[model samples]
Target: MSNIQAMIVNVRVDNLEASLPLYKELAGDVEVMRFPYEDMNLALVGPFLLISGPHEKHISQHATILVESLPLVVDALAKAGAEIVDEPSEVPNGTRLVARHPDGAVFEYLQPRA
Candidate 1:
């Protein structure tokens, strides 16, 4: 039997070029690397996605996108209609923020900046 392991993640973006900076800024140069796909005509980055081209029913189905900065992410997503699963608050000695995607997928944006 083949071992089942979770690998890779993708997000469909209406404009890949525009979203690149966000991921770049979020995950500095060292954290991410990009590959060009001309024949396929797509730019594939690391686990952080920057897919451009089209958005259809098949894409954007069920996904919970998480960002690194909890407080910043929560405020930003809330402005974009992300349902507040929980506010950005401290827990024990750390902190975390939670939110839900439109499709009901829950995401916890964590920042342990250690």
Candidate 2:
């Protein structure tokens, strides 16, 4: 079904050190992912993901969906009236595209590098 793989709900926090402990308590023994594009850190705690970084106008809390095929999904989404916010670009371990659906919901789609 649409080749959707995994979904990560990203939460933007003001301080990483302050919030990390709480998340660690909730989801013990988890690994954290660091992003180079921005001063951001991500931790997968249970079914939730915590993304902490400085408060910036361009950075907002959003959900990321991993897909099998980026171009296919992008084309389909565009046909469905989704406004592409960021074009497909290389990230740390994959390519990411940001878009907003017609319902005013924004999401980031990721396709891991092959």
Candidate 3:
């Protein structure tokens, strides 16, 4: 049996305002809530995950999410004007897509193996 559980993942960012738009597109139809934090913000997407503000300290490094389709996401992100840092790569584990937001935050989109 798999010991998997559902919870929320919080990713800290530098600018919440600028980052929310990009995250909104990725979240698709998922309902999201945003909480402003003086200098940063926290975006909650159900019980799945949350993307915080895009601050200087929070830029460059962040967490990742596993999606079912990498190619589709890549295309969508491209259309949204996201900068592709690493193209889709298929490894033994799964496929990975990397990108950087306008504020220089690195994002990893992973499609886990079966």
Candidate 4:
């Protein structure tokens, strides 16, 4: 079985503050993990990952998945004929890579920094 840790739904918004309250409420008032990546601002509230910024800077990934091992996930994705949308790179919280599966579903896989 895949060593998937947690999966976060990706949500895009024009204004982070305006959209946060609703997501925060739905997430049971969880603490938010906020960070900046490139030209975008991201926030993690429980299972919801909110991203706000220019639309051009955002990739249409279906979800952000927290994984145990990014390298392992990369190897598995290669064997599964998935296309690497973004190479593994350091983000605020960890390293991440975006991949498009054979069926055309795109996802972001993240491995938190040790």
Q: Rate the local accuracy (lDDT) of all candidates.
A: 0.52, 0.76, 0.62, 0.91
Identify the superior model by lDDT, candidate 1 or candidate 3. Answer: 3
What is the per-residue lDDT of model 2 for residues 7-59, given as tens digits with 9 covering 90 to 100?
88776667766777787777677775545456667656654667765556453
Q: Give the per-residue lDDT digits (tens) of candidate 1, residues 1-114.
A: 312122234665677678777767765663444544322224434455455553442223233233445556666676878887666675432365567766676664546434
**Cα error of candidate 4 at position 41, Å:** 1.4
True-structure RMSD, every candidate: 13.6, 2.3, 11.5, 1.2
Candidate 3 vs 4: which has more lDDT: 4
Give TM-scores for every candidate, taking all chains together and pairing residue i with residue i.
0.36, 0.81, 0.45, 0.93
For model 2, the stretches where C-alpha displacement exceeds 4 angstroms are: 39-47, 59-61
Record all residue pairs in model 4 with backbone atoms less than 3 Å apart, i.e. clashing.
Answer: none
Q: List the residue pairs that clash in candidate 3.
A: 13-53, 13-54, 13-55, 14-53, 14-54, 14-55, 15-54, 15-55
Q: Which ten residues in a row have the lowest lDDT in candidate 3?
A: 1-10
State the lDDT at 88 in candidate 4. 93
Task: Go through the candidates in order and give the clash count of each.
Answer: 0, 0, 8, 0
Best by TM-score: 4
- Residue 84 displacement (Å), model 1: 1.0
Best by lDDT: 4
> What stretches of model 1 exceed 4 Å from their correct place?
1-67
Q: Write one digit per residue (lDDT tens) for candidate 4, span 39-65.
A: 888898899988988878557999999
